[model samples]
Target: MKKETFLAFVALFLLTLTSVVYALEETTKTVTIAEQKADITGDRELDTILLKGVPYQDETDYLKQIFLEVSASNGTAYTIPLESGAKASFQLVDMNDDGVKDLFSSVQTGGSGGIVLSYLHSLKDNVLVDLPVPDPVEIDSHFLNGYQAEIKIKQTGKTYRFLLKDRKSYYKKLGLYYKGKLNEPTELMVNSYHSLKPITLKDGKLGLKGVQRVAGIANADTIAYVESTWAYLNGKWKLDNVKVLEKDQ
Candidate 1:
């Protein structure tokens, strides 16, 4: 074969191989992780709800693409996409007071911060809609002198102070503190929703409770926790209250 012809053939072969590999990476295999029977369409008929996702390369517990498949009794099938994470699960609850079950899902991020992603969806009247989850509470935290830290909840204008005398040795070793004083201005790390779940309120209505973590220098470092209560009213979510608790020693 001529040298030019042989080089062209080699290039073609390499191109074909690259295309095949790219296709495999783009392809995803989905599997059902959980299934349940519930009436979410407000039709008083059973609906088959299947939680499906694509595992991250044979990691059965970690999903890359999570979705929901609902087969309504009225001969309608719906697909809803959700965030990806590990240990994906859902609960059927009447969260919006529509008298129909809503799909509330939670996924563990499996990160050092122990963060979680939550979602809510309603399929009432054969229409699928996403219900917005409550946003994390905004906070302003900073290291203070005298081995102390302060966190202020911006929403409620509440401030909390923590004494870190017990952790003085650890903070000193990490150069975060020197002689009971902060070496420099540093802010505490606040993580997103660690857990969000439906709860029954005082007025016999369903609402959501979200818990957030505030860490010191490191994610595992102890600091405080913020809890927020929310109520769904007038077609929107309303913040009921906020609570701050110091981390147990």
Candidate 2:
């Protein structure tokens, strides 16, 4: 072979190698807790990424800029623009039971206590599409009503309900006291927390069990209470079977 041809071949090979190295650097990234990153696709690969920008100089500026960079395993890159003042994070789950994972994002909305801003996003045709997320009232209470697959927020004296509807979350109804009364809350009314514990049901399908802890009603000294299995259906949180778990002075 000619020496000139050999030189040309070597140059092309070097250029191709350089492009591959640059692509790898762009695809590999690190996420910090402050960013609230998650793998929204459920692909077991962290393709979704979020980066927050500095706040505006004026406090009145309601929009806080955010950059969402998605890097596919096949060397595809996409940048999405999002605006919110709160620090953002995400949870990836199959919210609609559609097998494909859905994205749930939350941002801290500061107030007397702390409020959270929620948003939902889903992947379609390899792009992130914004979906409606459940929004509860301004969370001024300490006890978060967060249960699995639901966004529950208890306000000062009232708890607002929200649930997924048609692949989007919306305000459903208000929570009632165990006695079937409009749950009128007070600063000293009650403070409760719930959890969505994973369990294997008799039907052999994986499910989440809702367990609520009624810590107090009026004050720390008030101990009379009840424990129940809660389920949200028909736009209401119904007590499956109420049992007088504890009662006292």
Candidate 3:
């Protein structure tokens, strides 16, 4: 993968983990912990990789693990290692409907850069083959914490926490908590870090999508955005029309 492509994924990932929330006074909304479902990957399918190891490594190691498949049916279960400092926890999933599981897992390096790479391995001719996620740009030497697929729900007037959308088009996990009865926020702020890019689902695979940054303001005519700065709306930023912006540059 080219370096810039990797860099975009890193940004999307950081946005998900950036921890975006402001003071309640300025931000009029509250998101109670609605539902927390723990899954290794964003896919709702069960995380079977945890069972591979007899004694699961320390909890932290789980964060930096990768997976390679070795099945008797697939001639010895070995392929190429795409990333470095390999520690892994992964389950098999058929991302391309090929009827066989291609190896897929989240991985990280222990070295100074410490970049995480998620990959796929397809069983072709009874062998495991590696395939990186398809992207328009090449990813190169970018720092990342992790990657995820997510869906964010916005109630008409309530605050809600964003969940991993079973259907993914965004690069990173997007979360939201909807609380209509609580205070309404003045604006909707999307804090972007690495890996936090626009995403959508296509052909049952997670694909890059687009995003818009909107400020919380409103006039009878139209919602306004100052370059890449603000957004205006009817119910303000927290609750209003879902449109009126463009993707980040």
Which candidate leads the pack in TM-score?
1
Q: List the lowest-lDDT window of 10 residues for candidate 3.
A: 136-145
Between which residue pairs do clashes occur in model 1? none
Q: In candidate 2, what are the lDDT values of residues 1-249, reduced to their tens digit?
A: 899999999999999999999997775443333443445555555664545444544653333555556665445666655546546555555444445666555555443223344455566445666754322222232222231121123322433322213212211233423223223432323333222332334444333343233322223323223233433334333333333233332
- 2 or 3, greater by lDDT: 2
lDDT tens digits, residue span 54-104, model 1: 987767778888888999999999988887887788999988888898999
Q: Rate the local accuracy (lDDT) of all candidates.
A: 0.90, 0.43, 0.32
Evaluated against the true structure, the overall lDDT of model 1 is 0.90
Give the Cα error of residue 60 in candidate 3, in Å.
Answer: 9.0
Off by over 4 Å in 1: 1-28
Which of candidates 2 and 3 reaches a greater TM-score?
A: 2
**By descending TM-score, how would the candidates be arranged?**
1, 2, 3
lDDT of 3 by residue, 105-224 (tens): 544444332333455556545444555442211111111112211113232232222222221332222222132221222233332211112122333442222122222121211112
Compute each candidate's TM-score over C-alphas.
Answer: 0.88, 0.37, 0.30
Residue 228 in model 1: lDDT = 96
TM-score of 3: 0.30
Error of 1 at 29 (Å): 3.8
Q: How displaced is residue 27 in candidate 1, in Å?
A: 8.8
Off by over 4 Å in 2: 1-48, 56-63, 74-76, 135-249
